[model samples]
Target: MHPALLEIARLGLHALPRASAGALRRYLETARPRLDLPPGEEIELFAPGARAVLARAFADIHHWLGQVSGRVPFFADIAQIAVPRPIPELAAAAAALPLLRADAPGHLADEAALAFLDRLAL
Candidate 1:
């Protein structure tokens, strides 16, 4: 990682209140695309039930923004994870606020679909 980005990840983001981190996480998710399928492939990828799960999550972004919130509990099931860096499954969810804020077409819909089982519990 770039020293500057690492430093900011530590100092810049860490300098803020806990609420800031929470808000930033939420905003990053909102910026991301809800799924990974191509525009025309949504039908093949997400069944009506699965799409509803994401719709609900999108509708409730403000209430559960962070990956850890369990509002979309499926996101928490990273295939593999360790300290500092997130697992590959959550790479997009790992984006920071500035990048996500500027991204017009973010990618993470697969993650949402993976979490659809949990959506029923919401």
Candidate 2:
């Protein structure tokens, strides 16, 4: 996995609610067999479940951020992560964020996802 992507997962997971984070961890644990496969193979086999799991995580993180920041629009507009893609694709997107836009919305969302993954020690 890309180092930047891993960092983003770390950030994202940290931003999630405790329950949501725990749930994701559990999912990862159960999905370990599929997750251990090579990137493309794992995604091809696990995309559906991965998308569902990640979508829930994203929504929970967004809600949590809104509650804490009191600026739903900021998160909604900037950090809204679409869940149609697999982790590798998402990680690529996170890796693609420009250094100049480190504080951009996508970056925030990426961070949240990274944090979540990091919490799982992924």
Candidate 3:
């Protein structure tokens, strides 16, 4: 488990399935500090080749996981290869989380997001 997941579990231990949207934000913020990743910045950088490398790697693992899914056995019982995300996306996502209000009315209460977030933290 990521440190953030553990923190989230500790945060919502009492609430369990009923943990609120604020918990999600707290989890994101908690996870953010340990990331040490560079912000993606949405292609704002001047460098072309290096930026492409970062963008392609980030997209391949996170945004475009589905495109690379079946080319190899994404469904296999064991993961033969593990692709890591670029530093930029990690930094960007963590930074952007604070801008969104976790207490907002439309937030989801699903645990699936927590699991996905945990993976993102990885």
Per lDDT, the best of the predicted structures is 2
By TM-score rank, best first, the candidates go 2, 3, 1
Per-residue lDDT of model 1, residues 1-122, tens digit only: 22112322343244445554444334333543432312221112233255455555554453455545656544454222112232221232223323432342243233332232122120
In candidate 1, how many Å is residue 51 off?
34
Could you tell me the TM-score of candidate 2?
0.26
Candidate 1 displacement at residue 43 in angstroms = 26
Task: Tell how far residue 10 is off in model 3, in angstroms.
Answer: 22
* Cα error of candidate 2 at position 14, Å: 31
lDDT of the candidates, in the order given = 0.34, 0.43, 0.41
lDDT of 2 at 102: 33
**Model 1 spans > 4 angstroms off:** 1-13, 34-122
RMSD values for the candidates in order, in angstroms, are 19.1, 16.7, 13.8
RMSD of 3: 13.8
lDDT, candidate 3, 1-122, per-residue tens: 23223333443444444454455645554544444434432313233356456545554465345455644433342231232333333344444433323422244445654443434331
lDDT against true structure, model 3: 0.41
For model 1, what is the C-alpha lDDT against the true structure?
0.34
State every prediction's TM-score relative to the real structure: 0.22, 0.26, 0.23
The runs of at least 3 residues in candidate 3 whose Cα sits more than 4 Å from the true structure, single-residue gaps closed, are 1-18, 39-113, 116-122
Pairs of residues at least 3 apart in sequence or in different chains that clash in candidate 1: 34-109, 35-109
